[model samples]
Target: MSGVFQRISSIWREFCKRRAYGALIHPDGIAAQAEELARLADLALRSTAALSALECRHLAQLAQSMRQLRETAHSPEFCRLSADRRLALHRQLLTAREKLLASLQKTQISTEKLQ
Candidate 1:
């Protein structure tokens, strides 16, 4: 029974790894993620009230990352990039997107509380 459980866990890990790789490296995947991240950042910047110093810095960093991701992923040189490089960029975009979302939610919650 223990052996069976170990096998299942191993299989699950492999599946997740492959899925993550494929999803990020597929033809349209990287570009789409970059666009989504940009949209989120824009929304957060436009809708939020006064941000903290840390939030402002984070938002600046996220904007820079989004621009870099867009340029790299869409460049003619992108096709020559290694799978690892593309995957890393995709991960960065995803992380930025999540952070922007969280920031936006926090701002909204605070605004509501003040109301």
Candidate 2:
């Protein structure tokens, strides 16, 4: 009986975690992320004269990924993902955004140095 209770408690905790994760990756959250990414990309492009070939390629790839993310966020399939899976997707999006921004910042600083 005690073991059964423990198992039930564990399951409940897992369910709650999933729900929280789902909320984090909800459409609204994705939309907000997409908007931020677009803003960042625009800023990077505005400084194209300071960017290297590699930086430009990275920005281009980032733009493509952002477009895909926007499309996925609007798709019915994305809406149906399990909360656990949604959390994973959210993390990936965040990581990608961070990397892109960091790369752009590094390029910007390097360009400024040449001035």
Candidate 3:
């Protein structure tokens, strides 16, 4: 039937997209990792401790990856997701932002004790 063919086509297209854009496909996991990285960055900035050379290099690498994610968000490939998936990504981003903000407060509290 034509309907069955269309469903199969859709599935194939989605699979291809997922393969091609693996980073953007799992927005929930990506958002969580981003939030955690941001929290660590915040802690580093707030703490009196100095960062080792390796830690600085790692943060530089993370900055480049974050920039790639920003660029990908503007690409047509990022728009290929279904509306529900896009909405879920948006919601996850918002949740991640809130968590990052909460983490900043905790980091501040702990760092203040060290000062």
Candidate 4:
């Protein structure tokens, strides 16, 4: 009976250790991810050949949002965020990427229009 109990306890401890390790997010990782997103947004803005007034405005807004996100990720407060909050921030980043892509797709000007 004692041996069985010890084995179960050891397994449970290992599982808990793995779970805790998986939950941690290094601050630098978050900062790097945010920077990459910002870079992509900036590249999209510069690479687009012809953006209408509305598209320009939308792109500007997206760029601002990306800047804010990057700033937030680098802040000390961000480092203190709970694991769940960090996860939520990661989800928000994904959503931001999708929005950026959608905005780019919508603003694509046909070559025929340019000519």
Candidate 5:
């Protein structure tokens, strides 16, 4: 083989090797994001069932993480799932965020009315 052909073959072999081992590499960022999303999901659930101050704190944190999650979803590395699942998750997060905000607003209005 000529010099260019030799270099091309060597590069192709290296790429294949990396692909074979890529899954074994730690995907810490993906894991971290999944953990965060799981936390937010739990908080969203808690908020729906309880109206205590702690639930409010969790909801606030979830809202902030959700904004970050939305940003992460837009990244090039993120893959879009089926349309149905994507829309479902989006609706869940948005509904939770809005619900929390509306409840807070109502509480504020009631407090103002009493004062």
Candidate 6:
């Protein structure tokens, strides 16, 4: 099983447990995790990993999308979404980039903080 799937499973388990604790399950929780798992499956199927500069660009794009989505967190649209959904979606996208980037230290260059 892919790491994404494993993470999704972990998230689902936590979600279920939350519900058992009387917590409401966000309708979009599964969708977000499913999207993440699908993304990983797509990557594995294509066999294109962080091995190339293209993958680096792809990861960067994913990071930018995540940032934009997060910026929307304070928007009314974000408020409309369930809290679980927002957290799950953020976790999926961020974890995807983190896992992929962990594999390529050369490409995993970090920028210095500027004043």
Candidates' C-alpha lDDT: 0.70, 0.74, 0.58, 0.69, 0.53, 0.52
The 10-residue segment with the lowest total lDDT in model 4: 17-26
Q: lDDT by residue for model 5 over 1-115, one digit each (tens)?
A: 5999999987787566446544322233333444455565555554353357776677666756755765666465544333333445555655664665566554422222444
Where is the poorest 10-residue window by lDDT in model 2? 106-115
Q: Estimate the TM-score of every prediction.
A: 0.60, 0.67, 0.43, 0.59, 0.39, 0.39
Quote the positional error of residue 33 for candidate 4 in Å.
2.1
lDDT tens digits, residue span 8-100, model 3: 998888777667656644654454555555555545544524555775565556545554555565567766666457556656656755654
Tens-place lDDT digits, model 2, residues 1-115 = 9999999997897688767675677877886787678678866876656766776777777776776777778789887766677787778878878887677666634255655
For residues 31-68, what per-residue lDDT tens digits would candidate 6 score against the true structure? 34444544553444344433466655665565455445
lDDT string, candidate 4, 2-70, tens digits: 999999987787556446744335566566667777787777778786776776677677677767766
TM-score of 1: 0.60
Candidate 1 lDDT score at position 95: 79
| Total colliding residue pairs, candidate 2 | 0
Alpha-carbon deviation at 64 in model 5, angstroms: 2.8
Report residue 18 deviation for candidate 4 (angstroms): 10
Q: At residue 25, what lDDT does model 1 achieve?
A: 75
**For this target, which candidate reaches the highest lDDT against the unseen true structure?**
2
In order, what is each prediction's RMSD in angstroms?
8.5, 4.7, 8.2, 7.0, 12.5, 13.5
Better of 1 and 3 by TM-score: 1
Of 1 and 6, the candidate ranking higher by lDDT = 1
Where model 1 places Cα greater than 4 Å from the true spot, the runs are 1-20, 52-61, 109-115
Write out the backbone clash pairs for model 3.
Answer: none
